[model samples]
Target: MDLPRDAQHDAVIVGGGHNGLVAAAYLARAGRSVLLLERLPATGGAAVSTRAFTGVDARLSRYSYLVSLLPRKIVDDLGLRFAVRRRGISSYTPHRDTGLLVDARDTARTREQFARLTGSERDFEAWQRFYAMTAHVARRVFPTLTEPLPTRAELERKVADPAAWEALFERPLGETVEAAFADDTVRGVVLTDALIGTFTHAHDPSLRQNRCFLYHVIGGGTGDWDVPIGGMGAFTDALADAARSAGARIVTGAEVTSIATDGRVAEVAYEDAATGRTHTVAARDVLVNASPHALAGLLGAPRPPRPEGAQLKVNMLLRRLPRLRDRAVDPADAFAGTFHVAEGYRQLQTAYEQAAAGRVPDAPPSEIYCHSLTDPSILSPELAATGAHTLTLFGLHAPARLFAADPEGTKRELLAATLAQLDAVLDEPLADCLATDADGRPCLEAKSPLDLEREVGLPGGHIFHRDLSWPYAQAPDAADAADEAGGPGTDVTQATGRWGVGTGCGNVFLCGAGAVRGGGVSGVPGHNAARAVLEKAR
Candidate 1:
């Protein structure tokens, strides 16, 4: 897949991860000559699968693991062949002997469970109200993520209608959830989503941003959280296939050294990994899917500092499924879906405060997922027979600077601390179920925030391309700041923002979680970025 030096392309996409690949597919489909480059030996970035162990095949970043918000339009328009298996998520609090299950397409049953847990007639009623309101907001706002940011006047018109603004963004999600439920259990269950994949504390004022997070889970129309048939990576592979099928050239193992811009357009100067040859590709535009921190450094600039509350990610691989004490539930059902391990709001708050201080929380909040339950194909036959599972522990915030001192040692201590917290809830023998790679040492410590930061080139290893806070919101004004700061192009209002895929700098776009939509497995960024590029061309 080698193109000669001086080969000119309509667009050059840096990074062959899922979002970049998706962008490439859409642009190539539109008759644009697009070139995608990847520094890794293979593409997919975090949405990748590797044989970390001899007999085990699992996805990297497994727990940030599910994909439900991928726009239905992308699936149909791209003729994507991947199948998404629907297995709902569940939450368990071992100490209280309480749990909640989110089933597929049964809002009534879910409400009933809420009523039972809360023992109040208002529980079900509030649940319905909250769902309806959030669903409405998601419908209005989620579309904008794929579309380019609206004009200020247009935005004023959209939000100028008092009812529309209240329904979409003005109302606080945290306060709404709190008012909706009488029992702590029901509130806890709903509020857990606020902190799910993010580093935000559950009680933090910023948690309101997650108001629509759960609503987008409805998949724009499909009603459940869906995982690709083979595994998460299947979606990535399908995207790559789609890009290639559309005549886009993807070169993995090629790292761009610098962007040689002639003050008007950008050219990519890169080193080919296989041949160690230096090559340059001139293009009308360059799309970068690397993290903002990484992109800044690549431009020979100092790393942009992360905001005060930005969090770190710690991913792990476990050998066996977690054991919970609820005898009413079958042991097999435990692995059937995702689980939130935090006990309550107070605990969640404490953990967040600790992480903010650069110390691992004494009881860190974790959202655990066992992918083997939904996608058994991800596991080897031997591992499957033994009831082995691939577990992902997310939302553990460790400081990036601390790791800069002693990467390996600090990472090990962080893992040990997280395991100690897990020991408080699960009954499984931690030692017996711990995963070991081919080396026979614990595999849990392999992927840390530092590794992600180093690999993706984001400053502070901040997974969300831009912090999803006030100044970083994905609006038109936000795009200006991104431009000034050289932030990743994430203008959610723009159609081309998906992968930032296109021809000129402004002509090219970005989407996926890294774009304005921030972070998530949802393909909204890619879908939206594509539409922007195509619409502008037209």
Candidate 2:
């Protein structure tokens, strides 16, 4: 059906990020008229690629750099022509003069390396057993992401392993890691997943780290973060294509200011950035693909506490891979996978303590990877042939609050400190390996939490939008659902039912990171929201 200019759409999706595009495509394919409005001149949000430095030929996955949480079901359902290349090595963490290298392709080598680092095979044996448990949980739980919300009891039964569930879900991740690993570096490597973008201690009673760890380990039922071939934009670009082909109208530079709903129908008011003219469109349902804070502002509801992000994102075009202090490892092999820096278990706890005290860590912990090593397609032929590479570093314990007073100054100070940590494990200074732009400036750029908020509209630069949620339904006897609504994106009401994406108003649903099981680059929330609309219609 050709929708008239003034026709009420079946769905009006605010924020044409990946999730919005996914929802629009699904709905439109189901013969529902869909209109997607985006504030930015472009879509993709954080999952986008761009040349950070002027005259640079390499396109970097500037923000969210890997493809882990994105489901293959979404890719196949949408027929997105995208691919991810796995690195041969999983990770490498350098200790004094030596390091621990986990090889994805060769477990025997990884075991040997572990034994060499820790002076015994006990930690390696424990590592294998611990991840085996997570793998079992991942296999059981990952499939539930695209399905309707399952009750906690139902999910628990599905997991089957009591030990795995208790270690991952009940106990603090710190206790679990401490019990499982003897080496500080190995323990830190395992715990890094729990603290990425989350500003929390390992032993925090809140179990926020546990939630973060679950999402990281459960992606695609394997938890391997593969490099998106042709950069991160490839996924969203394909999503946009699929949405348009399915007859969804995508309006870029349209700022959706407010959503007015009365349970049954909704009016979306947006201002076109180009014309500076306001337009209100009626829709049977609305899908929000923005942060919880943005959603509250749109619905004219009380804003929740701002979620603080805790990482400094740095993107760089390197002339060549930096040499490592450990001569046993090749730079190519080291950069091919995640290179751990200043992230020993004790170091991580100390950094968290310092950051919590409103100071940058003396030595910032970080995970660095050279995406070009696995997928050189992100670089131009010239750059790729010249051995030029892309380095993406995610610095931890640098919370948004640390940069609130002076974002620029703190960003510079933090970058200096973070790079200093990286250099400690390297043979030479990282600055010397940076490629120069046309204007002769180093091709390195760092984004503090404030920068993410300003540029990507991420509230407080919380990349997962807010704290990640458990992927199950609350118990029937649980406290008022509205009170238990962990994020502003979720607002339970009498009309809301099994779907976790539902809002207080019946006609609105969240299809963004704030939605349950909706963080990362995964389009699960969008898929679930569309499914909810379909189920309601049925």
The model with the greatest lDDT is: 2
- After TM-score superposition, the amount by which residue 107's alpha carbon in candidate 2 deviates from its true location, in angstroms, is 1.2
Q: What's the distance in Å from true for residue 471, model 1?
A: 13
Local distance difference test, each candidate? 0.60, 0.88
Model 1 off-target regions past 4 Å?
Answer: 1-5, 57-64, 105-124, 151-168, 202-208, 211-223, 262-264, 297-303, 307-322, 397-406, 434-446, 469-508, 535-538
Candidate 2 has its poorest 10 consecutive residues by lDDT at 486-495
Write the residue-wise lDDT of candidate 1 on 424-528 in tens digits.
666665666777777677655345666766665444565555554321233445444444333243332232222232212353344445455546666665665
Residue pairs whose backbone atoms clash in candidate 2: none
Against the true structure, candidate 1 reaches a TM-score of 0.83
